[model samples]
Target: MALTTKVAAGFGGMALVLMAGSGIASAAPDDSVIVNSTCTYPQVIAALNAEDPVAANALESSPMANGFIQDLVNTPPSGRQAKIDKVRAYPAAAQFSGLIAQVANTCNNY
Candidate 1:
């Protein structure tokens, strides 16, 4: 083959490899959070809203979140609002809050 043809082929292969790697790197962090029997996204939202531990448990088997909901639900009405504000303000949990908010709005889950 001509040297030019070989050079072009080499660059094309490198580009394909780089692009595939970048795609893998850019993928959502939750991609590894297996969805084994996980509830449909909508069910997740509904369970969250209802704060039904049984329903939430079945939805995602996310004990921590469901447990939080249970505590929130059991809190006095006046205190629950503060708890919610704290939850939304949680730095690490903020991304999830934003995602849920976007989903809720787009899904017309209002």
Candidate 2:
């Protein structure tokens, strides 16, 4: 899958947790926090909206996003880190690394 697709999947999966209100503890604002299921939908969206409205909008409105989310949701929480780690390991991760960090940093405040 394309790197963007992978990211979309990751975010989509996270979105599910957000909607479910997983109530996970706030993680330190960093890329690693992207795998955390605790960050609420509002918190993540707000962070994304503040940092990159376009990406935030895409996340909210993208049709393929739901499929991506479903893919992530199917994975067990214990394995999410591996999935994220694999994505991060991709060279493409450098391009959106900052965006991920920004979301994590802002959302962790909630």
Candidate 3:
């Protein structure tokens, strides 16, 4: 993938992460703590672990992807979709969408 595509996908993932709250709310632990906390790398890891240990472990395994995720979470939520839409023309759009949902689900639960 081009660097542009990778960056856009990162943003899409972030947007999805932010938008992922609807499905798992009932089963999830209280994430109110997230509101006051900054989305630091360690904090993000903890959040993912709290909601999805497998995903968290996977994240912990990749330092570069972890940094990318840290950047994504730090991004303002309002601008994420536009970034996502820019990459919708790519053939990987469908996969990007799926990735967004998965990452968002992980992030949103916390």
On TM-score, the candidate that comes out on top is 2
In candidate 2, what are the lDDT values of residues 4-69, reduced to their tens digit?
Answer: 565565464442221211233333234245555555556767777888887776666665654554
Off by over 4 Å in 1: 1-59, 102-110
Backbone clashes, candidate 1: 0
Each candidate's root-mean-square deviation in Å? 19.8, 8.3, 8.9
- Runs off by more than 4 Å, candidate 3: 1-12, 17-38, 83-110
- lDDT for each of the candidates? 0.33, 0.53, 0.43
Full-model lDDT, candidate 1: 0.33
TM-score of each: 0.33, 0.54, 0.41
- Which candidate's lDDT is highest? 2
Pairs of colliding residues, candidate 1: none
lDDT for 62 in candidate 2 is 61
